[model samples]
Target: MTTGTSKAGMMMELSHDSTLRELTTDQGVLRYHEAGDGQPLLMLHGSGPGVTGWRNFRGNLARFSEHFRCLVLEFPGFGVSDPADGHPMATATDAVGRFLDGLGLHQVDVIGNSMGGFVGTRFALDNPDRVRRLVTIGGMGRNFYSPGPGEGINLLMEFTENPTRERLVQWLYSMVYDPAMVTEELIEERWAQATEPDTLAAARRMYGKAAFAATAAAAARSEEAPLWAMLHGLRAKTLITWGRDDRVSPVDMSIVPMRTIPDVELHLFPNCGHWVMIEQKAAWESTVLAFLTRKDAA
Candidate 1:
Protein backbone atom coordinates (compact mmCIF):
# COMPACT_ATOMS: atom_id res chain seq x y z
CA MET A 1 0.00 0.00 0.00
CA THR A 2 1.26 3.49 -0.80
CA THR A 3 1.44 5.90 2.14
CA GLY A 4 0.41 9.53 1.66
CA THR A 5 0.42 12.57 3.88
CA SER A 6 -2.83 14.07 5.10
CA LYS A 7 -3.63 17.64 6.11
CA ALA A 8 -3.59 16.43 9.70
CA GLY A 9 0.02 15.22 9.42
CA MET A 10 -1.07 11.57 9.62
CA MET A 11 0.05 9.04 7.02
CA MET A 12 -2.91 7.63 5.14
CA GLU A 13 -3.07 4.69 2.82
CA LEU A 14 -3.69 6.24 -0.58
CA SER A 15 -4.82 3.03 -2.27
CA HIS A 16 -6.17 1.55 0.97
CA ASP A 17 -5.51 -2.20 0.66
CA SER A 18 -5.20 -2.19 -3.14
CA THR A 19 -8.95 -1.67 -3.48
CA LEU A 20 -8.67 1.83 -4.97
CA ARG A 21 -7.46 2.31 -8.53
CA GLU A 22 -8.01 4.36 -11.65
CA LEU A 23 -8.65 3.33 -15.24
CA THR A 24 -8.79 5.35 -18.44
CA THR A 25 -12.13 5.19 -20.22
CA ASP A 26 -13.19 6.78 -23.48
CA GLN A 27 -15.00 9.34 -21.35
CA GLY A 28 -11.72 10.10 -19.52
CA VAL A 29 -10.40 8.94 -16.14
CA LEU A 30 -12.64 6.62 -14.15
CA ARG A 31 -11.90 5.96 -10.49
CA TYR A 32 -13.19 2.92 -8.61
CA HIS A 33 -12.82 0.45 -5.76
CA GLU A 34 -12.82 -3.31 -6.28
CA ALA A 35 -12.35 -6.58 -4.39
CA GLY A 36 -13.00 -10.35 -4.35
CA ASP A 37 -13.38 -12.35 -7.56
CA GLY A 38 -16.11 -14.06 -9.60
CA GLN A 39 -18.85 -12.68 -11.79
CA PRO A 40 -18.59 -8.89 -12.02
CA LEU A 41 -20.94 -7.03 -9.66
CA LEU A 42 -21.04 -3.28 -10.21
CA MET A 43 -22.47 -1.07 -7.47
CA LEU A 44 -23.49 2.50 -8.16
CA HIS A 45 -23.93 5.15 -5.49
CA GLY A 46 -26.59 7.79 -4.85
CA SER A 47 -26.39 11.55 -5.64
CA GLY A 48 -26.41 12.91 -2.12
CA PRO A 49 -24.03 15.79 -1.30
CA GLY A 50 -20.42 14.50 -1.28
CA VAL A 51 -21.63 11.00 -2.13
CA THR A 52 -18.97 8.47 -3.23
CA GLY A 53 -19.25 4.79 -4.07
CA TRP A 54 -16.90 4.00 -1.17
CA ARG A 55 -18.90 6.07 1.26
CA ASN A 56 -22.20 4.60 0.09
CA PHE A 57 -21.15 0.93 -0.07
CA ARG A 58 -18.25 0.67 2.39
CA GLY A 59 -20.27 -1.20 5.01
CA ASN A 60 -21.68 -3.74 2.59
CA LEU A 61 -18.69 -4.07 0.23
CA ALA A 62 -16.76 -6.66 2.24
CA ARG A 63 -19.65 -9.12 2.44
CA PHE A 64 -20.67 -8.63 -1.17
CA SER A 65 -17.05 -8.91 -2.33
CA GLU A 66 -16.79 -12.28 -0.61
CA HIS A 67 -19.49 -13.58 -2.95
CA PHE A 68 -18.57 -11.83 -6.20
CA ARG A 69 -16.06 -9.56 -7.91
CA CYS A 70 -17.27 -6.18 -6.66
CA LEU A 71 -16.68 -2.92 -8.54
CA VAL A 72 -17.98 0.43 -7.29
CA LEU A 73 -17.35 3.56 -9.34
CA GLU A 74 -17.11 7.25 -8.60
CA PHE A 75 -19.44 8.64 -11.22
CA PRO A 76 -18.47 11.58 -13.37
CA GLY A 77 -19.25 14.94 -11.69
CA PHE A 78 -19.00 13.15 -8.35
CA GLY A 79 -16.06 12.36 -6.11
CA VAL A 80 -12.68 12.25 -7.85
CA SER A 81 -14.05 11.41 -11.29
CA ASP A 82 -13.92 13.99 -14.06
CA PRO A 83 -16.86 16.37 -14.44
CA ALA A 84 -19.38 15.90 -17.23
CA ASP A 85 -19.65 18.13 -20.28
CA GLY A 86 -23.23 17.15 -21.04
CA HIS A 87 -26.29 15.85 -19.22
CA PRO A 88 -25.10 14.31 -15.96
CA MET A 89 -27.18 11.16 -16.30
CA ALA A 90 -26.24 10.48 -19.89
CA THR A 91 -22.64 11.31 -19.13
CA ALA A 92 -22.64 8.86 -16.26
CA THR A 93 -24.35 6.16 -18.25
CA ASP A 94 -21.90 6.55 -21.10
CA ALA A 95 -18.97 6.51 -18.71
CA VAL A 96 -20.29 3.28 -17.22
CA GLY A 97 -20.51 1.62 -20.61
CA ARG A 98 -17.10 2.92 -21.57
CA PHE A 99 -15.65 1.81 -18.26
CA LEU A 100 -16.81 -1.75 -18.80
CA ASP A 101 -15.65 -1.72 -22.39
CA GLY A 102 -12.23 -0.43 -21.33
CA LEU A 103 -11.94 -3.31 -18.89
CA GLY A 104 -13.17 -5.78 -21.53
CA LEU A 105 -15.99 -6.80 -19.20
CA HIS A 106 -18.49 -8.80 -21.24
CA GLN A 107 -21.37 -8.78 -18.77
CA VAL A 108 -22.03 -7.67 -15.20
CA ASP A 109 -24.65 -7.81 -12.47
CA VAL A 110 -25.61 -4.25 -11.63
CA ILE A 111 -26.91 -2.74 -8.36
CA GLY A 112 -27.80 0.92 -8.37
CA ASN A 113 -28.99 3.09 -5.48
CA SER A 114 -30.98 6.30 -5.84
CA MET A 115 -29.41 8.33 -8.67
CA GLY A 116 -27.28 5.32 -9.46
CA GLY A 117 -30.57 3.48 -9.83
CA PHE A 118 -31.63 6.04 -12.39
CA VAL A 119 -28.36 5.47 -14.25
CA GLY A 120 -28.72 1.70 -14.03
CA THR A 121 -32.29 1.84 -15.31
CA ARG A 122 -31.22 3.77 -18.38
CA PHE A 123 -28.17 1.57 -18.85
CA ALA A 124 -30.25 -1.59 -18.72
CA LEU A 125 -32.77 -0.09 -21.07
CA ASP A 126 -30.10 0.86 -23.61
CA ASN A 127 -27.61 -1.97 -23.10
CA PRO A 128 -29.68 -4.90 -21.91
CA ASP A 129 -27.19 -7.43 -23.25
CA ARG A 130 -24.42 -5.99 -21.04
CA VAL A 131 -26.24 -6.73 -17.81
CA ARG A 132 -27.13 -10.18 -16.51
CA ARG A 133 -28.87 -9.35 -13.22
CA LEU A 134 -30.29 -5.99 -12.19
CA VAL A 135 -31.11 -4.45 -8.82
CA THR A 136 -32.44 -0.99 -8.11
CA ILE A 137 -32.86 0.62 -4.67
CA GLY A 138 -34.95 3.75 -4.16
CA GLY A 139 -34.54 4.51 -7.87
CA MET A 140 -35.75 7.75 -9.35
CA GLY A 141 -38.21 8.21 -12.28
CA ARG A 142 -41.05 6.39 -10.53
CA ASN A 143 -44.84 6.68 -10.25
CA PHE A 144 -45.74 5.01 -6.95
CA TYR A 145 -47.08 8.51 -6.38
CA SER A 146 -46.56 11.73 -8.35
CA PRO A 147 -42.89 11.84 -9.54
CA GLY A 148 -42.39 15.54 -8.82
CA PRO A 149 -39.47 15.58 -6.32
CA GLY A 150 -39.79 14.76 -2.61
CA GLU A 151 -38.10 15.36 0.74
CA GLY A 152 -34.72 14.15 -0.50
CA ILE A 153 -34.76 16.37 -3.54
CA ASN A 154 -36.03 19.30 -1.49
CA LEU A 155 -33.18 18.78 0.99
CA LEU A 156 -30.67 18.57 -1.86
CA MET A 157 -32.02 21.77 -3.34
CA GLU A 158 -31.58 23.44 -0.01
CA PHE A 159 -27.99 22.26 0.21
CA THR A 160 -27.08 23.39 -3.32
CA GLU A 161 -28.94 26.65 -2.95
CA ASN A 162 -27.60 27.46 0.50
CA PRO A 163 -24.48 25.26 0.65
CA THR A 164 -23.88 24.69 4.35
CA ARG A 165 -22.51 21.94 6.51
CA GLU A 166 -25.54 22.20 8.76
CA ARG A 167 -27.86 21.72 5.81
CA LEU A 168 -25.78 18.84 4.51
CA VAL A 169 -25.92 17.17 7.94
CA GLN A 170 -29.66 17.71 8.03
CA TRP A 171 -29.97 16.19 4.59
CA LEU A 172 -28.02 13.12 5.71
CA TYR A 173 -30.20 12.80 8.79
CA SER A 174 -33.35 12.88 6.68
CA MET A 175 -31.95 10.11 4.43
CA VAL A 176 -31.60 7.46 7.13
CA TYR A 177 -34.14 5.83 9.50
CA ASP A 178 -31.84 6.14 12.52
CA PRO A 179 -30.05 9.28 13.61
CA ALA A 180 -27.32 7.12 15.14
CA MET A 181 -26.09 6.33 11.65
CA VAL A 182 -25.36 10.02 11.15
CA THR A 183 -22.08 9.90 13.00
CA GLU A 184 -19.78 12.87 13.31
CA GLU A 185 -17.08 11.23 11.22
CA LEU A 186 -19.55 10.55 8.45
CA ILE A 187 -20.88 14.10 8.60
CA GLU A 188 -17.39 15.55 8.60
CA GLU A 189 -16.24 13.42 5.69
CA ARG A 190 -19.24 14.30 3.55
CA TRP A 191 -18.91 17.96 4.47
CA ALA A 192 -15.25 17.92 3.53
CA GLN A 193 -16.05 16.56 0.10
CA ALA A 194 -18.99 18.88 -0.45
CA THR A 195 -16.84 21.90 0.36
CA GLU A 196 -14.25 21.21 -2.33
CA PRO A 197 -14.24 24.13 -4.73
CA ASP A 198 -14.61 22.16 -7.95
CA THR A 199 -17.13 19.73 -6.44
CA LEU A 200 -19.20 22.61 -5.09
CA ALA A 201 -19.17 24.24 -8.52
CA ALA A 202 -20.32 21.01 -10.14
CA ALA A 203 -23.12 20.77 -7.60
CA ARG A 204 -24.37 24.23 -8.53
CA ARG A 205 -24.55 23.18 -12.17
CA MET A 206 -26.49 20.07 -11.13
CA TYR A 207 -28.86 22.23 -9.12
CA GLY A 208 -29.55 24.29 -12.22
CA LYS A 209 -30.23 21.14 -14.22
CA ALA A 210 -32.65 19.99 -11.54
CA ALA A 211 -34.41 23.35 -11.52
CA PHE A 212 -34.91 23.23 -15.27
CA ALA A 213 -36.36 19.74 -14.93
CA ALA A 214 -38.81 20.93 -12.30
CA THR A 215 -39.94 23.83 -14.50
CA ALA A 216 -40.47 21.54 -17.48
CA ALA A 217 -42.40 19.15 -15.26
CA ALA A 218 -44.65 21.99 -14.06
CA ALA A 219 -45.49 23.02 -17.63
CA ALA A 220 -46.27 19.47 -18.76
CA ARG A 221 -49.83 18.20 -18.71
CA SER A 222 -50.71 16.34 -15.55
CA GLU A 223 -52.63 13.86 -17.74
CA GLU A 224 -49.52 12.95 -19.70
CA ALA A 225 -48.66 9.97 -17.48
CA PRO A 226 -48.38 8.77 -13.89
CA LEU A 227 -44.77 7.59 -14.37
CA TRP A 228 -41.65 7.59 -16.57
CA ALA A 229 -39.82 4.24 -16.73
CA MET A 230 -38.75 1.59 -19.26
CA LEU A 231 -39.28 -1.34 -16.95
CA HIS A 232 -40.93 -3.43 -19.64
CA GLY A 233 -37.81 -3.35 -21.83
CA LEU A 234 -35.37 -4.62 -19.20
CA ARG A 235 -34.51 -8.30 -19.83
CA ALA A 236 -32.28 -8.95 -16.81
CA LYS A 237 -33.50 -10.84 -13.76
CA THR A 238 -34.21 -8.01 -11.37
CA LEU A 239 -34.71 -7.45 -7.66
CA ILE A 240 -36.15 -4.10 -6.66
CA THR A 241 -35.43 -3.32 -2.99
CA TRP A 242 -36.95 -0.52 -0.96
CA GLY A 243 -37.25 0.59 2.61
CA ARG A 244 -40.76 0.72 4.06
CA ASP A 245 -40.26 4.17 5.56
CA ASP A 246 -38.32 5.51 2.60
CA ARG A 247 -39.44 8.98 1.65
CA VAL A 248 -36.89 9.36 -1.14
CA SER A 249 -38.49 6.57 -3.15
CA PRO A 250 -41.55 5.14 -1.50
CA VAL A 251 -41.94 1.41 -0.93
CA ASP A 252 -45.05 1.18 -3.06
CA MET A 253 -42.98 2.46 -5.98
CA SER A 254 -41.62 -1.07 -6.17
CA ILE A 255 -45.02 -2.08 -7.48
CA VAL A 256 -44.48 -0.04 -10.65
CA PRO A 257 -41.44 -2.07 -11.70
CA MET A 258 -42.88 -5.32 -10.39
CA ARG A 259 -46.00 -4.95 -12.54
CA THR A 260 -44.16 -3.66 -15.60
CA ILE A 261 -40.95 -5.69 -15.72
CA PRO A 262 -41.05 -9.21 -17.20
CA ASP A 263 -39.02 -10.80 -14.39
CA VAL A 264 -38.73 -8.96 -11.08
CA GLU A 265 -38.93 -9.48 -7.32
CA LEU A 266 -39.65 -6.85 -4.69
CA HIS A 267 -38.27 -6.66 -1.16
CA LEU A 268 -38.95 -4.01 1.47
CA PHE A 269 -37.07 -3.40 4.71
CA PRO A 270 -39.41 -2.40 7.51
CA ASN A 271 -38.32 0.59 9.62
CA CYS A 272 -35.52 1.44 7.21
CA GLY A 273 -35.19 4.54 5.08
CA HIS A 274 -33.47 5.29 1.77
CA TRP A 275 -30.20 3.67 2.88
CA VAL A 276 -31.37 0.07 2.98
CA MET A 277 -27.96 -1.44 2.29
CA ILE A 278 -26.48 0.61 5.11
CA GLU A 279 -29.19 -0.07 7.67
CA GLN A 280 -29.86 -3.70 6.75
CA LYS A 281 -26.39 -4.69 5.61
CA ALA A 282 -26.64 -8.43 6.25
CA ALA A 283 -30.10 -8.97 4.86
CA TRP A 284 -29.54 -6.68 1.90
CA GLU A 285 -26.24 -8.27 0.85
CA SER A 286 -27.47 -11.82 1.36
CA THR A 287 -30.67 -11.23 -0.54
CA VAL A 288 -28.79 -9.61 -3.43
CA LEU A 289 -26.15 -12.34 -3.52
CA ALA A 290 -28.83 -15.00 -3.67
CA PHE A 291 -30.60 -13.24 -6.50
CA LEU A 292 -27.48 -12.75 -8.60
CA THR A 293 -26.21 -16.28 -8.01
CA ARG A 294 -29.51 -18.03 -8.57
CA LYS A 295 -29.31 -20.75 -11.23
CA ASP A 296 -32.32 -19.34 -13.02
CA ALA A 297 -31.10 -15.71 -12.91
CA ALA A 298 -28.13 -15.27 -15.25
Candidate 2:
Protein backbone atom coordinates (compact mmCIF):
# COMPACT_ATOMS: atom_id res chain seq x y z
CA MET A 1 0.00 0.00 0.00
CA THR A 2 2.93 2.35 0.60
CA THR A 3 5.33 3.26 -2.21
CA GLY A 4 8.12 5.22 -0.53
CA THR A 5 11.63 3.74 -0.05
CA SER A 6 15.19 4.88 0.65
CA LYS A 7 18.69 4.11 -0.63
CA ALA A 8 19.27 1.86 2.35
CA GLY A 9 15.67 0.74 2.79
CA MET A 10 13.04 -0.50 0.28
CA MET A 11 14.27 -1.38 -3.18
CA MET A 12 14.15 1.38 -5.75
CA GLU A 13 13.82 -0.83 -8.86
CA LEU A 14 12.79 -4.24 -10.14
CA SER A 15 15.01 -6.95 -11.59
CA HIS A 16 14.66 -7.90 -15.25
CA ASP A 17 12.53 -11.02 -14.78
CA SER A 18 9.69 -9.93 -12.48
CA THR A 19 7.56 -7.03 -11.35
CA LEU A 20 8.53 -5.61 -7.98
CA ARG A 21 5.54 -4.99 -5.71
CA GLU A 22 4.77 -4.15 -2.09
CA LEU A 23 2.10 -5.49 0.21
CA THR A 24 0.82 -4.13 3.49
CA THR A 25 0.52 -6.39 6.51
CA ASP A 26 -0.10 -5.89 10.20
CA GLN A 27 3.55 -6.58 10.86
CA GLY A 28 5.09 -4.40 8.13
CA VAL A 29 5.42 -3.90 4.38
CA LEU A 30 6.69 -6.93 2.37
CA ARG A 31 8.70 -6.44 -0.80
CA TYR A 32 8.43 -9.14 -3.49
CA HIS A 33 8.60 -10.10 -7.15
CA GLU A 34 5.79 -11.86 -9.07
CA ALA A 35 5.55 -13.55 -12.44
CA GLY A 36 3.51 -16.15 -14.41
CA ASP A 37 -0.05 -17.27 -13.61
CA GLY A 38 -0.82 -20.65 -12.13
CA GLN A 39 -0.71 -22.40 -8.77
CA PRO A 40 1.22 -20.10 -6.48
CA LEU A 41 4.71 -21.30 -5.57
CA LEU A 42 6.03 -19.21 -2.69
CA MET A 43 9.84 -19.02 -3.01
CA LEU A 44 11.81 -18.35 0.15
CA HIS A 45 15.48 -17.36 0.27
CA GLY A 46 18.37 -18.21 2.57
CA SER A 47 19.75 -15.90 5.33
CA GLY A 48 22.79 -14.89 3.34
CA PRO A 49 23.51 -11.15 3.40
CA GLY A 50 21.75 -9.02 0.75
CA VAL A 51 19.57 -11.98 -0.20
CA THR A 52 16.39 -10.74 -1.82
CA GLY A 53 13.87 -13.08 -3.47
CA TRP A 54 14.82 -11.77 -6.87
CA ARG A 55 18.51 -12.10 -6.35
CA ASN A 56 18.05 -15.70 -5.25
CA PHE A 57 15.40 -16.86 -7.72
CA ARG A 58 16.13 -14.87 -10.85
CA GLY A 59 17.74 -17.89 -12.49
CA ASN A 60 14.92 -20.37 -11.87
CA LEU A 61 11.91 -18.08 -12.20
CA ALA A 62 11.77 -18.20 -15.98
CA ARG A 63 11.61 -21.99 -16.08
CA PHE A 64 9.35 -22.32 -13.03
CA SER A 65 6.92 -19.69 -14.34
CA GLU A 66 6.04 -22.00 -17.19
CA HIS A 67 3.87 -24.04 -14.81
CA PHE A 68 3.59 -22.10 -11.58
CA ARG A 69 2.93 -18.58 -10.43
CA CYS A 70 6.13 -17.69 -8.65
CA LEU A 71 5.98 -15.31 -5.70
CA VAL A 72 9.50 -14.61 -4.47
CA LEU A 73 9.53 -12.73 -1.18
CA GLU A 74 12.21 -10.79 0.68
CA PHE A 75 11.23 -11.27 4.30
CA PRO A 76 11.00 -8.34 6.68
CA GLY A 77 14.42 -7.04 7.80
CA PHE A 78 16.01 -8.52 4.66
CA GLY A 79 16.76 -6.82 1.37
CA VAL A 80 14.49 -3.81 0.71
CA SER A 81 11.60 -4.87 2.94
CA ASP A 82 10.84 -2.66 5.89
CA PRO A 83 12.09 -3.62 9.33
CA ALA A 84 9.55 -5.11 11.77
CA ASP A 85 8.97 -1.73 13.46
CA GLY A 86 8.15 -2.36 17.11
CA HIS A 87 7.64 -6.10 16.63
CA PRO A 88 10.51 -8.42 17.39
CA MET A 89 12.31 -10.03 14.42
CA ALA A 90 10.05 -12.62 12.77
CA THR A 91 11.29 -16.12 12.10
CA ALA A 92 11.10 -17.23 8.49
CA THR A 93 8.40 -19.72 9.50
CA ASP A 94 6.22 -17.06 11.16
CA ALA A 95 7.00 -14.50 8.50
CA VAL A 96 5.77 -16.83 5.74
CA GLY A 97 2.34 -17.05 7.36
CA ARG A 98 1.93 -13.30 7.76
CA PHE A 99 3.39 -12.70 4.31
CA LEU A 100 0.99 -15.06 2.52
CA ASP A 101 -1.99 -13.83 4.53
CA GLY A 102 -1.25 -10.30 3.39
CA LEU A 103 -1.71 -11.56 -0.19
CA GLY A 104 -4.72 -13.80 0.67
CA LEU A 105 -2.80 -16.96 -0.25
CA HIS A 106 -4.30 -19.52 2.05
CA GLN A 107 -2.37 -22.35 0.45
CA VAL A 108 0.57 -22.71 -1.93
CA ASP A 109 3.49 -24.87 -2.94
CA VAL A 110 6.45 -23.80 -0.79
CA ILE A 111 10.13 -23.93 -1.72
CA GLY A 112 13.04 -22.74 0.40
CA ASN A 113 16.84 -22.75 0.53
CA SER A 114 19.30 -22.94 3.45
CA MET A 115 17.70 -20.83 6.18
CA GLY A 116 14.68 -20.63 3.97
CA GLY A 117 14.56 -24.42 3.98
CA PHE A 118 14.58 -24.47 7.77
CA VAL A 119 11.75 -21.97 7.85
CA GLY A 120 9.67 -23.92 5.32
CA THR A 121 10.09 -27.15 7.26
CA ARG A 122 8.85 -25.54 10.46
CA PHE A 123 5.97 -23.88 8.67
CA ALA A 124 4.92 -27.21 7.22
CA LEU A 125 4.86 -28.69 10.67
CA ASP A 126 2.82 -25.85 12.18
CA ASN A 127 0.47 -25.03 9.29
CA PRO A 128 -0.05 -28.28 7.46
CA ASP A 129 -3.25 -27.10 5.87
CA ARG A 130 -1.66 -24.05 4.28
CA VAL A 131 1.25 -25.68 2.46
CA ARG A 132 0.34 -27.82 -0.54
CA ARG A 133 3.85 -29.21 -0.83
CA LEU A 134 7.21 -28.59 0.83
CA VAL A 135 10.70 -28.44 -0.66
CA THR A 136 13.94 -27.53 1.10
CA ILE A 137 17.56 -27.12 0.00
CA GLY A 138 20.36 -27.40 2.53
CA GLY A 139 17.66 -26.70 5.12
CA MET A 140 18.98 -25.85 8.62
CA GLY A 141 16.11 -26.46 11.07
CA ARG A 142 17.39 -29.95 11.84
CA ASN A 143 20.45 -30.62 13.95
CA PHE A 144 23.90 -31.02 12.49
CA TYR A 145 24.75 -34.68 12.06
CA SER A 146 28.24 -36.21 11.99
CA PRO A 147 30.08 -33.21 10.58
CA GLY A 148 32.89 -34.41 8.31
CA PRO A 149 36.03 -32.50 7.41
CA GLY A 150 35.64 -30.83 3.97
CA GLU A 151 32.36 -28.97 3.54
CA GLY A 152 34.07 -25.64 3.08
CA ILE A 153 32.88 -24.51 6.50
CA ASN A 154 35.92 -22.40 7.31
CA LEU A 155 34.94 -20.21 4.38
CA LEU A 156 32.27 -18.50 6.44
CA MET A 157 34.72 -17.80 9.23
CA GLU A 158 37.36 -16.55 6.84
CA PHE A 159 34.93 -14.15 5.18
CA THR A 160 33.64 -12.94 8.56
CA GLU A 161 37.11 -12.04 9.73
CA ASN A 162 38.26 -10.38 6.52
CA PRO A 163 35.16 -9.38 4.48
CA THR A 164 37.37 -8.79 1.50
CA ARG A 165 36.67 -9.73 -2.12
CA GLU A 166 39.38 -12.36 -2.05
CA ARG A 167 37.84 -13.88 1.05
CA LEU A 168 34.38 -13.75 -0.46
CA VAL A 169 35.61 -15.29 -3.66
CA GLN A 170 37.11 -18.07 -1.61
CA TRP A 171 33.86 -18.52 0.28
CA LEU A 172 31.93 -18.61 -2.96
CA TYR A 173 34.27 -21.29 -4.27
CA SER A 174 33.49 -23.40 -1.26
CA MET A 175 29.83 -23.23 -2.22
CA VAL A 176 30.28 -25.13 -5.48
CA TYR A 177 32.12 -28.10 -6.93
CA ASP A 178 34.08 -26.09 -9.45
CA PRO A 179 36.00 -22.87 -8.78
CA ALA A 180 35.08 -21.55 -12.23
CA MET A 181 31.42 -21.57 -11.26
CA VAL A 182 31.99 -18.56 -9.03
CA THR A 183 31.94 -15.84 -11.65
CA GLU A 184 33.42 -12.39 -11.24
CA GLU A 185 30.09 -10.64 -11.90
CA LEU A 186 28.38 -12.81 -9.30
CA ILE A 187 31.08 -12.08 -6.76
CA GLU A 188 30.89 -8.36 -7.49
CA GLU A 189 27.09 -8.35 -7.06
CA ARG A 190 27.08 -10.31 -3.81
CA TRP A 191 30.04 -8.34 -2.43
CA ALA A 192 28.18 -5.07 -2.97
CA GLN A 193 25.01 -6.36 -1.33
CA ALA A 194 26.82 -8.07 1.53
CA THR A 195 28.60 -4.80 2.37
CA GLU A 196 25.69 -2.38 1.91
CA PRO A 197 24.40 -0.44 4.91
CA ASP A 198 20.84 -1.85 4.89
CA THR A 199 22.05 -5.45 4.65
CA LEU A 200 24.67 -4.99 7.35
CA ALA A 201 22.15 -3.34 9.68
CA ALA A 202 19.61 -6.12 9.21
CA ALA A 203 22.27 -8.79 9.71
CA ARG A 204 23.20 -7.24 13.05
CA ARG A 205 19.60 -7.36 14.23
CA MET A 206 18.77 -10.79 12.78
CA TYR A 207 21.94 -12.64 13.85
CA GLY A 208 21.70 -11.01 17.29
CA LYS A 209 18.06 -11.97 17.86
CA ALA A 210 17.67 -14.73 20.44
CA ALA A 211 14.86 -16.48 18.58
CA PHE A 212 16.96 -16.93 15.47
CA ALA A 213 19.96 -18.19 17.38
CA ALA A 214 17.79 -20.62 19.36
CA THR A 215 16.19 -22.15 16.27
CA ALA A 216 19.53 -22.65 14.55
CA ALA A 217 21.02 -24.13 17.68
CA ALA A 218 17.98 -26.30 18.33
CA ALA A 219 18.35 -27.63 14.84
CA ALA A 220 21.82 -28.72 15.84
CA ARG A 221 20.35 -31.31 18.17
CA SER A 222 19.49 -34.69 16.69
CA GLU A 223 17.10 -35.36 19.53
CA GLU A 224 14.97 -33.53 22.14
CA ALA A 225 14.72 -30.27 20.21
CA PRO A 226 11.52 -28.64 18.99
CA LEU A 227 12.66 -28.98 15.38
CA TRP A 228 13.17 -32.74 15.47
CA ALA A 229 10.31 -33.23 17.93
CA MET A 230 7.82 -31.89 15.41
CA LEU A 231 8.98 -33.93 12.43
CA HIS A 232 5.83 -36.07 12.39
CA GLY A 233 3.64 -32.97 12.31
CA LEU A 234 4.64 -32.19 8.74
CA ARG A 235 1.62 -33.29 6.67
CA ALA A 236 2.69 -32.19 3.23
CA LYS A 237 4.63 -34.51 0.94
CA THR A 238 8.18 -33.18 1.19
CA LEU A 239 11.33 -33.18 -0.90
CA ILE A 240 14.68 -32.39 0.72
CA THR A 241 17.69 -31.51 -1.41
CA TRP A 242 21.25 -30.76 -0.41
CA GLY A 243 24.66 -30.19 -1.88
CA ARG A 244 26.69 -33.16 -0.71
CA ASP A 245 29.53 -30.71 -0.20
CA ASP A 246 27.49 -28.16 1.72
CA ARG A 247 29.60 -27.40 4.76
CA VAL A 248 27.27 -24.84 6.26
CA SER A 249 24.14 -26.99 6.72
CA PRO A 250 26.13 -30.20 6.34
CA VAL A 251 24.86 -33.01 4.12
CA ASP A 252 24.71 -35.21 7.18
CA MET A 253 21.81 -33.19 8.56
CA SER A 254 19.58 -34.75 5.93
CA ILE A 255 20.02 -38.13 7.61
CA VAL A 256 17.68 -37.35 10.52
CA PRO A 257 14.68 -36.47 8.35
CA MET A 258 15.34 -39.48 6.17
CA ARG A 259 14.61 -41.64 9.21
CA THR A 260 11.99 -39.50 10.96
CA ILE A 261 9.68 -37.93 8.39
CA PRO A 262 6.69 -39.94 7.19
CA ASP A 263 6.39 -38.87 3.58
CA VAL A 264 9.76 -37.45 2.56
CA GLU A 265 12.64 -38.03 0.17
CA LEU A 266 16.17 -36.65 0.12
CA HIS A 267 18.21 -35.93 -3.01
CA LEU A 268 21.92 -35.32 -2.80
CA PHE A 269 24.02 -33.61 -5.45
CA PRO A 270 27.69 -34.32 -5.83
CA ASN A 271 30.18 -31.50 -6.40
CA CYS A 272 27.64 -28.97 -5.14
CA GLY A 273 27.65 -26.68 -2.16
CA HIS A 274 25.08 -24.60 -0.27
CA TRP A 275 23.42 -23.09 -3.32
CA VAL A 276 21.94 -26.14 -5.01
CA MET A 277 20.03 -24.24 -7.67
CA ILE A 278 23.11 -22.39 -8.78
CA GLU A 279 25.75 -25.10 -8.66
CA GLN A 280 23.63 -27.68 -10.48
CA LYS A 281 21.46 -25.42 -12.56
CA ALA A 282 20.03 -27.86 -15.09
CA ALA A 283 19.54 -30.76 -12.75
CA TRP A 284 18.11 -28.55 -10.01
CA GLU A 285 15.58 -26.90 -12.30
CA SER A 286 14.52 -30.06 -14.09
CA THR A 287 14.26 -32.11 -10.93
CA VAL A 288 12.14 -29.49 -9.20
CA LEU A 289 10.01 -28.99 -12.26
CA ALA A 290 9.33 -32.71 -12.38
CA PHE A 291 8.67 -32.92 -8.67
CA LEU A 292 6.20 -30.03 -8.65
CA THR A 293 4.38 -31.41 -11.67
CA ARG A 294 4.32 -35.01 -10.58
CA LYS A 295 1.10 -36.16 -8.95
CA ASP A 296 2.47 -39.31 -7.30
CA ALA A 297 5.43 -39.87 -5.03
CA ALA A 298 6.83 -42.63 -7.20
Candidates' lDDT values, in order? 0.78, 0.72
What does candidate 2's lDDT look like per residue over 188-259, in tens digits? Answer: 888888777666556555443453456456657746556766687788888888888776677777877777
Model 1 residue 166 distance off true place after TM-score fit, in angstroms: 1.7
- By lDDT, the best candidate is 1
Name model 2 segments beyond 4 Å from true.
1-18, 85-89, 141-145, 148-154, 157-162, 206-224, 296-298
lDDT of 1 by residue, 200-278 (tens): 7767666655654764575475554423456787898888888888866666667768888898888888879999998
For each of the candidates, give the backbone clash count. 0, 2
RMSD of 1: 5.4
TM-score to native of every candidate shown: 0.88, 0.82
